[model samples]
Target chain A: MRAYGFRVPGGFHATHTYEAVEAAERIGYPVVMKIVSPDVVHKSDLGGVRLNISTAQGVRDAFDLMMLRINQRLPDARIEGIYVEKMVSKGLEIIIGMSRDPQFGPMLMFGLGGVFVEVMKDVTFYIAPITHDEAMQMLMSTRSYKMLVGARGQQGVDLKAIATGLQRISQLSTDFPQIAELDINPFIVGEFGTDPVAADVRMALQSPED
Target chain B: MLEPLLYPKTIAVVGASKKPGKVGHEILANLIKGGFTGKIIPVNPTADQVLDLPCYKSPVDCGESIDLSLIVVPNRAVVEAVKSSIKAGAGAIVVITAGFKEIGEEGAALEREVAEICVSHGVRLLGPNCLGLINTENRMNASFGGDIPMAGGVSVISQSGALCTAILDTAAGLNLGLAKLFSIGNKADVSEVDLLRVLGRDEQTKVIVGYLEDITSGDDFIKAATEASTIKPVIILKSGTTVAGLKAASSHTGVLAGADTAYGAAFMRSGVIRAENYEDLFDFATAFAIQPLPKGDRVLIITNAGGPGTMAADAVENAGMRVMSLDRNVATALKSKLPAAASVGNPIDVLGDADPDRYLAALEAAQEDDSVDAVIVILTPQAMTRPVETARAIVVGCQKGDKTVLASFMGGRGVLPGRDALAAAGLPQYYSPERAVAALKAMHDYAAWKRRPPRIVARFRVNTRRVERIITRCLRANRRQLG
Candidate 1:
């Protein structure tokens, strides 16, 4: 799920695994390569992720290294080959999630993305099928949102874009019954006025019976 | 006086037994032992006589009508007991049995049967599965539990029996009072919403506190709470906030929420002060019962030491209150009165070497300042700082000023003398700045909630047809499956 995230601009599960290298070459240089193995949830932790693969040879080498790393890291499971995609530049990272709660049902969570998600629980939630007003309210609830609004001469990220993205996930949850949770971390919210793109999308589907 | 319900004039233990360990014997013993000023009748069918009272075979044989009948029998037998109580002209019934809705599907059916019986007879049912209710106002101990609570101001309503006992035990140690306590278990018929609506109107109850794991009727609970909060503060310590907690609650009592965050947002919107922990729940309840509502969010800090005062200022700000800058004249007065080395700011730090007079002078000046809405006096142990005398001065200052006064005495045993002095004067004291700030914030929040226009959500009466369809679908899908 995490590996599928690096496949930027390509809708999830749209392209074949074997064509990923050719797709990256066709797309552009400075791409990222990650191992798409169900057994390895935290791919980055096990050295299954490699960034800045500028050439076709670089992609192949990184892919080979990732395969060897996964073999050593996860000996018992099957590997689903590798994923290759374009790399995104540094930008403000935000985390967005959808979780089903017993009390409130499905809820949309917004907070500062990346490792900060755990350390700083600076987050807010709005129940699914959220109104635009609720989506805006969720964005403003976090202290990090203040920072995103250009607190220190840093350009303010496009909040409307973030809200729209949140609304999409909320709608997705309502539409796709199998999608239990969707995590978009470090959704590189670009410099002021640019639409924020999902730098990574890790989605968990409910079991077939569920 | 609603004596029959709130302060029963006469009581009878319908299932009173000779067995020392049984609930029936314990209740009879509690009433007699607690000095209940009412006629007591022990009714037991199997025994000719019991508990030294005029033992009767049934409620019918108890001679005169009994005002309250406490039934502590098995689940299946409860329906008969309720019928007998109504037949005997008992005004109210306290049923202490477990095998009701709390047990499972079969028990829920039995609970509905019991409620139907109570409603038909026009008899008020306390619980089909409950620890029972107690009225401390007139010393009426109708609950089947063994413990007797201290009678005072704060009234508690808990959904869990064991939690009720815990609250009573905790209340006793804190020297808090109880006007009434209800353990509305299973809530098969009588619910928290009903009790809240009734208790909200009770004059004796200045503050209403609750420990609920699940809210059966969210709409009704919110309505009663919103109305009640207008008159008295309603403090709730809601459990089942986490995923695991919610699961545990479902197993304990069938409760499901769409999400926890929605509950949180609803709590805030409804003007209910949600306590983060058990201690805060009781602490805030105690503070609300004693302290006057703070007028505004602007607060003043006065301390014998600078560190604690500054810390308090930061905490106050964190609690959504502004630490007001002292008035120029007040700052000048404090500067002149204190040593030259002392900082003459909003937190008029009168150095560790300051005297009680200096502390009093700072507080007096701050109290009179129009900018300062409230005053937080910090007492840190030092070679010259007189904790007891300083506490007395602050208490006196509190009595004189319209502004609220809060104190934080930071040491251990050394702080106790000051704490005891504050307590004697009915002044609220905290062991740390964070606690003091939290208490002050709660006071401010309550005051704000009280002033706002009441937000009453129109009760959405269940659409029986729609609900029936959902239930039928659920039953057809699988009784064991829960989404």
Candidate 2:
């Protein structure tokens, strides 16, 4: 099953191994290491995530600690190592999700991201394969969107780009039954005019047929 | 129209058994124990005697024509039992069996088959997967399920079996009686709409209450409720109003609709009263069942405490009813009755130290004013404020006046005497200002709706037709595939 994300202009993927850590050190500083285990969808829950690694030893130490933590917490999960991506700076956080309801068919949910998803519970749902109209409605329903629209002198996040991204996620969930859940948290909205980038992504796929 | 089914003169347990713990035997025991005035027949194949009544082999074998049949048997045998009951000319059948639509596709097909059987035979089926109905007024225990209900004015119809029992138990604790109770689980033939339509016309049914997960026939529910609201009040406690709540409801009942905003609009247009919580629903129903509708939306606030009066004012305003400002004459009259230090406003805070006679005097003055449509008297505990005597005085003053009187006693333990005294006098009383204000608002709204014509204009004209066509085609396709 293919997992296609919205196109980020300068985005590139880097596979993390013992050698990749050394390469990352040679290339740059301030990288994020995320556990790439398909079984562990929420890597941060098991402490398999390390952010803002600035040095060679920082990379090596974080890798060791993350590996040990993942093995200790989820002993049965297969370790596919990790993905080291450039540490993107702060932005307006949001979450988009989809699930097939038995009665209402496919449903798309969009809301404020991070811990605020539970705390604020500012979310809206629509039957999936959502039109652009519905996507815009979901964004407008949430109070966090106030900040996205430049509340309190903050630069307004690009709403058109966010709406397009949401539409892609909805289509993806409708297209693949195997894709149970997917999340891209803190997809940093770079500047006033710059497009948002998916900084950290975690996905869960259905087990292969017996 | 079907009085015998509701208040049966003769009820026959088709699958009755001599075994002590069986459903049929338990139902018979409960019916006999509840002192049902109707004649009971036990139909068993082998046993000559069960529950001290002659047990026949079948409904045909039992000589008398039965009004209702309580069918408690396995899934395969239900069809045969229903067929026999139909041949014996039974009017209604309450099927207390599971393994139907609620399970999955195949079970849904079986449920349709049972419904078809009922339709073809002209026998109204209460449920294929239900606890069945109870007419407490007539001591008619038709349900095979456990709860022996008490007689009261509130009639509740629940979509869930467990919730029905829970509401019954809670109502029992609250000293509320149910006029009739129905657990319409998996409503194959008889639906909530059907029951609502029937009970709406029932004379003994003062308050028609419901606990619903979904409205299967949205148009039918709107139509039935619109007509029902013309005569009686319909209070509903619907669960699936939020996305998370919709998820829980689906897992509980497997039915989901669009957003709750649409449902709210539909409910408003149909003139149905929606309650926020379980306690609110029961409290509103109790008040509606007992109290007369308010003459107008103008409300007079009477309180011994200032904070509760403010709270009552807020609640009253929130419910879209006005808190009446005291007339100059009424204020002058109240000033003469109250002490000089007392605040003689609309809420008429007569001071906590005021006696029962002072409360009576204030209420009398407020009630005499033509501008005051209703009066809500609030009492708080104080050293000199005789709670019981003050309640009696207010009740007496209410009896003498033309205005509707409502009371709020705002404390935990100190409010019992006031509540009991009001209840004994058949006057509406609430524990909190919010509840008292809500009840008064509902009374006001009901009176207003009664004056106006029913306002449902049939949205979903094309969508409903399309859905009906789709359902018809699907049913026909499924029948062909099965055959």
Candidate 3:
């Protein structure tokens, strides 16, 4: 995703406590650690995620504690390692994704992260390989567009950042047909010209026969 | 390639029959009654002759350069009939036979086999389960569905044969003319995409209408529909949504991408006007077929009754269009020409007792106003109202300008003459003000789509090599899904 120009946080996989501490130091203090496993989804729910670990000792302890809890909860799961990364600042939560339509090929989707998508289903879609104008139109089509523009005198986030993220996802989905479905939940975005972070990513691949 | 299918000079009915009410018999009779100039050979194995024409045992025995062969044989013999038609030098085929794909796996396999044979022979097939097709330009009614439609610019394609009949009946009742009609059942080879391109280039077709349950391919459909919509209006009434593709969804994105969402997106991007129901299909078609495309979204309502005028105003507002207030000079001109009781606002109420001349005066003023792009004239049955004369005045008022004018003569028995007069002048008349406004909204939206600048999709610089490597590694590890 970073290769496609999306602003992903600095991160690396670490298999041991020493490696986790060193990676956290390399990324600088005030970092986050998440369990790296293909079998385990919802890392936060599984207690496999720790945030705001400002010290090297804190990174070491968080890594050991996350591994122990994950191991106890999901004994059959295969743990790839732990992911140490820089913690991004707070911003408006938005979701950008791509799901290959059985008929239309790649389709890009946009909506606010929480209730707008989960409960209201207030989302809009456009076929992949969309233009900048189309990406902007997709955002404006959603019922929650005013939220991104700052409703009720609140500070609005950078709309171009979200649109660019959608365009990049479109390009990625078009480039890699095997990447069938992808979701960048909580794509934290700030005001205009400010880079947004793809804080978490979930992706799936097309089965061989399909 | 589809010229032969749509404009065949010679046709052969492979399952021609002798009994009344039979599919084959009705098709042959309709062809003859439709006054087709081309030779129509009836091929029946059992009968020596049918409908007083020399019937051959098969299309193969006919020994003619058959441009199109209409097959209505039983399901088991459909493949054989198609094979024989191909052997007889059939350029195209239309299999009206049912029981393919819609029945079961066995039927689907049989349909595929028939399609394969056509493909191997380089022949285009219309249907293995359809209502056949009709070309009014060639004066041919090659389907067993119904009578020949009146010839005009609106062409229709339907996925449902039953809906095709309903559309035909409605068109006939409404006196709407059709250029061509195809019931693309089971779209084994010639799908809606193929027909869209064909109709898009057809000289006689000004409006393309469709009744689709589902599209063959979404990407191809968007491409074809986009192109066709550029040439002329394409109105589609799509119904039904199946969750067949959502069962394997593993992500929230996949789950949110419902069965119908993609279709909606595709339609919007393609500039195709989606009609919400059967009525909308023809209403929009007729509006596009006859009325000029509005240059702007500003509309002026001219009505005899204030209530219907307000209804029209509400409908226009709800559709995101403007019931624009006339300018000061235009309002002054209208007030001078109209009665003192008439309100000169957006809904220019000419009063309940208004006659043809008052309606004409308001219409003329609206047409001359630069802010008004369209005008909806509504009339109700009153003691002094003249339905027929008011309709004629509307026709004459709109005859000089490019401004679009529609009507809503809101009564069943009393407004028939007015509606008939509007129909005669090729003016679209709805039964209610809201319906008229809805049709106007469709026209405005289509005009907006056409006015948009050409789409230029941006291609970003990306590391494709790395993507390929990652996908290859994942698949090599037998992990079909990656997190």
Candidate 4:
């Protein structure tokens, strides 16, 4: 996504505790740390994620603790390395995703992330690649659109930036037929001019035999 | 590709029979009675004559080249019939035979074999287990679905033959005219996409209606439907919307991306008006065919009673349309013409006892108001209410304006004459306020869709080579699931 000009947080991979400290100092804290393994699909579920590590010593401790938790939980999970990244501030949480529909090639999905999406199922979809206007319409079609427009006197997030992000993802999905399903959950969006960051991403590819 | 199927110059009933109750005999009889101007040749080995037309032993023996062949033979002999028809220079084929594809694997294979022959010869095929088609433009009633429909602007396409008959019945009852109708059974060769493209280009059709059990290809449907919808309103009623074709995945989007949702998104993107039920399909078709598109969503209601006026207001709001307060000038104009007991707000209630003149006054004022995009005239039969006269008044006031009008004559026997009058004047009248409101909303949405900005998909400078390399490397390593 970053290759397609999407805003993503800076991060580095470190295999050892000393390397983790060095990478954190270079990237600057407060930062987030997580276990990087092909086996551990959901890092936070396995207690493999740590946040608000503001210093080099904090990064060292968080990395060791996350690894220890993952090893104890899975027992046989492969631990590739530790991922350290800059932490974005509190912002509105939105999810942007793509699922390659067998009939229609690629469908882009949008919703307010977390409980709103899980409980209410307030989501909308559009076939990609969509125009920027279509992306905006997709966002407004949801029941949670008022929340994005700043409900109860709260500040509204940068909606144009979100539309642009959606366009980029739509292009990405159209460009790569190998990508079967993708999700950028909690794409943290801040007020007005602030750029939204893709906090976490997951993508799946079509089976080789297919 | 479908020219011969829709406008055949010469048609051959391949299984034409002497027996009246037989499928072949009814189809041949329908062709003669429906007033098809072209030559109708019946092909049957056992009969020399059918319904006064000379019968040929086979299509190969028909002497003249056949533009279309309607086959209604037994299941086992369908393939041979199609082959002989194609051999006799038939441009298109409509197999009215049953027990193919809808039966089982053996039937499906036979259907495929027949389709393969049609494809190899470049001849279009309509169905192997379906009802035939109708074209009112040429006075051709090729189907055995009974009488030839009155020629009008609305055309229909349905997957189920029974639904086609029901639509035909409803259309006749409602006095809605039709241009062309097709029953695409099994869709072995020609599907909705092909018909959409053809009908979208057809000048005689103003509105296209469809009933589909399933679409053959989603991408092709979007392309064809989008093109058709841009030309005119394409209303469809699609059933079988269960959560089929879902894949187990790790994301919320993947879990929620079912067949129904994808179809919904596709329809939205392509600008197709989706009808919720059988009634909605005709209601929408009636509105689109008879009335001009509303320029905006603001609706003005004119009624003879308070309850129906209020009902119209509530229905308008519920349909996402605005029952806006009347413009000040229009309100002032209505006040002077109406009785003192009448209210001249959004629902300009011209009292329960008011007659045709009061409706004429309110409708005239609404016609000149630029802010009101549509008008709904509701009438309830009262002791002194003139249903027929008031309906005529509405026709006179609304006939010349850009603003479209829909009427809701809210009673059965009392409003029959008035509803017929409105129908004759090419104005859509509904049974109730809710139905009228639904139709008006459909027009509003289609107008808005037409007024939307041109679609421009942004194409960025993408790294195609890198994406190709990554995909190739993953597939080569047998790593289908990647992060």
Q: TM-scores across all candidates?
A: 0.71, 0.63, 0.93, 0.95
Q: Judging by DockQ, tell me the better candidate of 3 and 4.
A: 3
Using TM-score as the measure, the top candidate is: 4
Better of 1 and 4 by TM-score: 4
* Top-down DockQ ranking: 3, 4, 1, 2
Interface RMSD, all candidates in order, equals 12.9, 14.9, 1.6, 1.8
Restricting to chain A, the TM-score for each candidate equals 0.85, 0.83, 0.91, 0.93
Tens digit of per-residue lDDT, candidate 4, span B1-483: 688888889999999989988889888888888899898999999987888888898998978899999999998998899999998889999999999899999999999999999999999999978889999888888888989988999888899998988999999888899999999999999899999999999999999999998889988999999999999999999888633355676777887777588888888888899898988998899999988899898999988888888988999998889997678977887798888989888788888898899888888888888989899999999999888888899899886687888989989898899898888777888999999999998888888888899999988776777777877887777655544
State each model's C-alpha RMSD to the native.
7.9, 10.8, 2.7, 2.3
Docking class of 4: medium
Per residue, candidate 3 scores C-alpha lDDT tens digits across B1-483 of 698898888899999999989999999999999999899999998999999999999888876789999999999999899999999899899999999999999999999999999999999999878998999998999988788999988999999999989989998877789999999999999999999999999999999999888888887899999999999999999888735355578777888887787888788889999999988998898899999999999999998887888899999988989889788898998899888889999799999999899988998888888999999989999999999999999999988688989889999999898888888778898999998989999999899989987788778888888878888887777666555
TM-score, cand. 2 vs. native: 0.63
lDDT of 1 by residue, B126-240 (tens): 7767777788766767776655677777998898888888888877656677899898887766777887788889989988999888887655766777788878888888887
Regions of candidate 4 where Cα sits further than 4 Å from its true position: A17-29, A52-76, A207-209, B242-245, B462-473
Restricted to chain B, the TM-score per model reads 0.84, 0.85, 0.95, 0.95
Name every residue pair that clashes in candidate 3: none
Displacement of the residue B464 alpha carbon in candidate 1, Å: 27
lDDT tens per residue, model 2, B1-483:
556568777787877867888777787777777778888888888889987888889988888788888887777788888888888778888888888988889888888888898888788887778877788877877765556666778899888877877787877655677898888888887888888898888877888999888877766777888788777999888886535234422110112223464355345546678887887787788778766778888888878888999999889888778888788877887788778988777677888787889889888887788888888889999877788888899888987777877788878777687677776665667788888888788778777757764322221112334423433463444321100
Point out the worst 10-residue segment of candidate 4 chain A by lDDT. Answer: A201-210
By DockQ, the best candidate is: 3
User: lDDT of each structure?
Assistant: 0.73, 0.72, 0.89, 0.88
Tell me the lDDT of candidate 4: 0.88
